[model samples]
Target: MADKLDHLLSDYFRGKLDVAIQLRQMELTYRHGTPDENIGGGRKQNDYNNVVESRMIHEQNDPELKRLRYQKSVIKMMFDCLIKSHQDVLIDKYGNKKGWVTIGMDNHIDERTARE
Candidate 1:
């Protein structure tokens, strides 16, 4: 169970940067506009139909974004609940990709303890 938690935390540390980047790109798309889908001669729909379709599409939730945000929040909540020393050890081992020896030395604990 400990190993599984460690692996999950390590993956979370690695993926957080990627998640931030993707979310930023999404934000930029919303800020600037999404690319024009109706380039050249496309279907000639009426203005009312176009407006209704756009509203429906925009109003729908994105499942991927929702999952990402939920995962981030849950991970953050778990991280926040740990004691400071354990948090430091986790950050060094997973976030910094440091070895157990180095983490033990930094925290002044036994190498085996740090690994555990």
Candidate 2:
């Protein structure tokens, strides 16, 4: 029962995190722009033109980046409440998307031990 519950919780958190990530990706995509393309070919392109385009890119992406950062911060804070090993396990399993066998190998433990 405990194992099943653990798996269920893992799936729940993974889904939540995935949704947050996908939303961020969509936000970024909607902000889609290519700096060079925007400033098309011109004979007298100067340093200021490049600088302006770079700034524009930063300004455009800032809001989406901030939203994503906040969501990730919230996730990290929640994970921080767990014991160290458990935190590592959850991060490796969900964030890194590793299988139990690979996680165990990376952490130098057996699969069953890693799963437990």
Candidate 3:
């Protein structure tokens, strides 16, 4: 019964988080824009130009580059909390832990942004 309740709670939280994430994605997509390829009667041409120009400036600015650096960002802490914290709950629900999968995923993250 405890396991059943835990499963239900996990599902409930996962569903809520997924919905929140989708909503946030919609909001960001609205800003980062569409590949519609038409200026149309939508945002003015200058507004579109500004967004592109802003990105160009960001690409050039040293302070912006430093701020953008994820080098200081630790993905391990995130995985430790999200995956490690939930490992037992997941094993209880699914009967196995993906230890190698987690290790492989960490390897991918390191490979993705490694400056070395």
Choose the strongest candidate by TM-score: 1
What are the per-residue Cα lDDT tens digits for candidate 2 across 76-101? 67777888887777778865679999
TM-score, prediction 2 = 0.37
User: Model 1, 1-116: lDDT tens per residue?
Assistant: 98976776777887864666477546634654455577768775653536546534643455655555666779889889999999999889888999999999999999999977
Best-to-worst order by lDDT is 1, 2, 3
lDDT tens digits, residues 1-116, model 3? 97864454444334543454345444443555356676576865554557556655544554523432332233224435765424444443333323434534544533222212
**For each candidate, how many residue pairs have backbone atoms clashing (under 3 Å)?**
0, 0, 0
Indicate the residue-level lDDT of 87 in model 2: 78
Q: Which regions of candidate 2 are displaced past 4 Å?
A: 1-78
Error of 2 at 73 (Å): 9.7
The collision pairs in model 1 are none
